[model samples]
Target chain A: MNGLSLTDLTWAVPLPVVIPLAAAGLALVLWRNARAQGVISVVALSLVLVTSVALLVAADDGPLVLDIGSWAAPVGIDLVADRLSTLMLTVSSAVTLCVLLYSLAQGLADNNAETPVAIFHPTYLVLTAGVANAFLTGDLFNLFVGFEMLLVASYVLITLGGTGERIRAGTIYIVVSLLSSMLFLLAVALVYAATGTVNMAQLAVRLQQIDPDVAFALQLLLLLAFGIKAAVFPLFAWLPDSYPTAPAPVTAVFAGLLTKVGVYAIIRTQTLLFPDGRADDLLMWVALATMLVGILGAVAQNDVKRMISFTLVSHIGYMVFGIALSTEAGLSAAIFYVAHHITVQTTLFLVVGLMERRGGSTSLDALGGLARIAPLLAVMFFLPAMNLAGIPPLSGFLGKAGLIQAGAEVGTPLAYTLVAGGIVTSLLTLYAIVKAWNKAFWQPAPEEPREVALPRGMVGSAAALVVAGVALTVVAGPLYDYTERAAATLRDREQYVTAVLPGGRGEGRSADVTDEARREGGTDRVEEGSDLEDVGPRGGEQPAPPEEETGSDEGTDEGGTP
Target chain B: MIDTSPSLALVVVAAALTAVGVYLLLERSLTRVLLGVIFLSNAVNVVLLVSGGRAGGAPIVDYTDEDSMSDPLPQALILTAIVITLGMTAFLLAMAYRSWQLNQHDEVQDDLEDRRVAQRAARDEAAYLSDDDGTTTLEQEAAEVHDETGDDGPPSSGPGTPPSSAPGSHAVPTPEGGDAR
Candidate 1:
């Protein structure tokens, strides 16, 4: 699209995942040198930011595909940098970088008392790598691997100090996460068994030919797995308990990135592999429930961190709402909301970290008169808090407006109910936030306040995120356009499928195996517009298109084996 | 075409593993929870094995004919999964040990907020009213939650008690009581 070939841009696709992984190894090796680890992580994430932005710009023209080690699609894992992924990647890298800077400042300010400095850098880098991997991977198995990488890193980060409360929270968090991972693994297994391959692009082409019932089962399994991870309604019990116990930076990043990765997976699988929208109504109800239930929990919380955690679960409903609509407009708004929420939510948590520092507690009753003491902290807290509440003229309002508009266009009774529920969720969010604001800032201090020097580094990083949230509003027009384009490409799955499997096959050396299978099976499917890539006779390891491809019978009869 | 159906034996074993795993999962002890996780992941691994179609010779280039060789992908996935599960197992064990060290028991504790809500519900009290009137003091709220070991009664209960004067200087309210479980 640009002067540079998409091939040239393709190299940037893997860099987002590879850079942090390589840096993680380096940081781990330099574990003794905290400063060195910090620098390595910073430089690595900055490079990821650069690469992701480049990919975001380039991907607007078309999806950028990278067959890992040149093994080709269906046969090997691939990384695709399409509009949706690159947009997510850019936003996530930005958020991670800011959170890293914030934590680095906290580490310096606390003199390394809060975070286990050596372990923190390496784990944080790995977490970023995992997020990048999840966003970029085009293979279902690799997606699971990406999820595991991030989840494991998170398990470590969440329980950093192994304190009593942290350990307790981490236990629930880890067990719930492990269960979800198992479910996801089971889903992957079933999807593979049903479709004969895990490469998403190939599965996109092949899954359509399978029995509808089996396909529906596979879809439900995937949704269940992702639902738990996303903290969707009914499966969100672990999140509020576990999230609040972590240190501020860890909580901020986890809140920002982890569930979104789950949302991202749901989006990819729903739109690409199963475009029929069979689960739309079910997802809609889940969305409504997540929103109302989550917000109600937030309203009932006495603690700031726990309140925010509940809000995080609640807001996930909004994204699910978009996905349920199964329309381009719905998808675009969901993407926009994701980007906005990451920045706003992370900023809120970081600001609350500052509050914890100044006020000496996260409890609403214990904290008072912060407006009189630290006006700067008050402003920092207020802006993102209101943004999170979706007040008008902010990016939150824009995203919500887009969703409401999209819902009206659908005009279904259920869609209208969700629209009403969404508005109610927004109002309740504002109520909870304002109540928090009054208690923390406006209420008279219960006692004479002592001066606690707010760390410049922490405040500065938090401020940067706040500004980034506002920047999203300033650039809402262009950002909305980008999301629209992303939604378009996502809805039209062919753009992604073709990019991954060019010439009706991946650009791998395995073409010979495919040719051999075609000859041996005596199927002239190569003449059928070359739409189907015959699963090679090598144990039917790849997917052969169902129904239309006659060669699959011979391929499978001879190749059926573990 | 592909004999995608799993064998009866594998299916039975997987089902049994899942049932046991789920049972263990519901146990209060962290070790049992870890075991549950291990069993459940193993069950999923077996399912992955089943997903590969049927057993055959090693899939290496020279060891077996291409058609006769097993689907190497699922096995590869299984290997990866096993390794990940192992790492998670180690982490969980360390966490369990830490829990044991901290509380001298590794039971998964109920959420503190849940305890508060339950207490409020038991009293037929409104959380909104308690929060609004400042009648239920922070100490009272903390004392009601007995997540860890050690028994103590509430310091003072009921309305119009002045809020703690040194709220900022107070330690995190450590409200310990006998195991609620």
Candidate 2:
């Protein structure tokens, strides 16, 4: 859409990851000055937000690939800014920016007690960089690296101040995350062994030639790894148990961004590598369970934070449901739902933090009369709460409507079951949210409500997030259109493959080495009807094993094995 | 093309390491869990080594023919995984040490909030038990679900006391901790 060239846009692809990382180091150096750390973090995240938006616009024309250090595809790692990734990056950066502002305000208001400025600023920045890297990376191993970057930072953030309770929660979170990382590593190793390359676009081309069973195994392993991170049902127990213990902004950011990254990975791989939809039925069942069981857990909770955490797990099912359909409408709606959930969930947590402050406790039994006492907090809580429940005229409602409509278009028995399950989940979400609202805002106070003064910075940032969620509803038309185009690009795998590997080779200096090597090695080998037969010296005198040479030769001669 | 078959010995060793690591991971002690994490990551790293085509000459382009060279990519990946595991090992150890200092034990504690939820469910179940039913009474259920963490009410300010009302526990300690809430 712009007058800029692909090379010019490609250069900006890595900045979202690099800027925060550089600022993280800078913040670490100035740790003694909390003000400087806060300013550096705010400025760095704002820059990331800006770059992500720019890429989001530029990628509308086509996917942009940056082969790091000019090493070429299937060899060097690459960072791709496609419509799906750039959109996710934009939403996540905006959410992270808002969370950063809120945390900065909390740090300043607390004089940096609960969150030590020295460690918090650096770790938070690293977390943002890791998230950006995850969204942008076109290499599977780099995605794993991105996950580790964030998880390690999250480990420190979760256990900040070394509180006994936090330490307990942090251990569970860390061990579980480490185990998932191990599985992901093993999956990466297997993918490399099976396909001989880790670049996703190349994998998209090569995986089609591998044994279908092995590809299916790889898919399941990857799903298992990401499922734990995403907190899907049966794997979601760790989420509500650990998340409520951290300070508010930390919990809010984790609630909003972390699991969605896992969802983003699932979307990318399902569409790009394994488009046959072998796992769609399985994903459908899993999504159904995640939705029903999560909301059931939410309904059973007596604490506001834990209740919200359960709902967070419940809503992840909706996104997975969309992916399971493997339809354009399904994917488009899933993407829209992911964007909506990130903002609304984060806003709810921040609002709950304010409620905790006003009520003197997060327990439903202890909190009461907050609607009369803090009318502003009540309104803040009400808007996002309703939006999360998929109330009409809200983004949440529009996203769910899209998913249901997509399911109806499919019209399978299971699809119908999912549609029914989805509606039930929505109703349950409303019930759970309404219950918490009634107890926290409407019920009579057991004791006098606290007169604590909510900091203007914290309230402003949280309010900004709430307004952003509402704004999603306001711009739902254009955003949905954008997601529809993104899903179309995702569905057409050739666009991604060709963009990353132009003309049967990556647009890098070293890509010619493989071509030259094949040419030199061809004199002694028999031609097997290769299109490269005319390009090289073909001989039939010495016939060699056709299997292995065919793979390497075809891979070089024709980027797509066919 | 190079030999792509992995050695059976490495595969067997990796399987054994994973088995033992998973067993240790099921243990309650943080130290054992830490060891489990170490063993498990190493097992995956070894698998990574095996995933690269069978051992060949050093991968240096000039030192070995292209056909005989080992795939260098998996090795690079393994190095990255090893470094990450090392950082994680150090962090987990520090956390284990801190846990021991605070609670005199390195065992991962069952979530107190989870226990409370279970206790509440049990109480509701007891309310359904008839006079002649064999189900346990409310008192017995409470004892069965009781934990070391206090269950009386909201947490009061003091050192050495478990924060019974753990959710929003920071709300009550604003003065000492300078909590933003």
TM-score for predicted model 2 compared with the true structure: 0.88
- Return the lDDT, model 2, position A461: 94
Runs of candidate 2 exceeding 4 Å displacement: A1-7, A504-562, B125-181
| Tens-place lDDT digits, model 1, residues A211-289 | 6667788889899999999999999999999898788999999999999999999999999999999999999999999
Q: All candidates' TM-scores?
A: 0.89, 0.88
| lDDT tens digits, residue span A1-562, model 2 | 2334553477789999999999999999897788898899999999999999989998998888877886655567888899999999999999999988988787777654555668888999999999999999999999999999999999988987667678888999999999999999999988877766788987786667656767788899999999999999879989998898888888999999999999999999999999999999999999999999999999888778989999999999999999999999999999999999999999999999888877777767667889999999999999999999999999999999999999999999999999999999999999989888877798777677667898898899999999999999999999999999999999999999877754443343334653553354343222211322221111111113443454354334323312
DockQ for candidate 2, C-alpha atoms: 0.26
RMSD of each: 6.5, 7.6
- Residue clash pairs of candidate 1: A562-B54
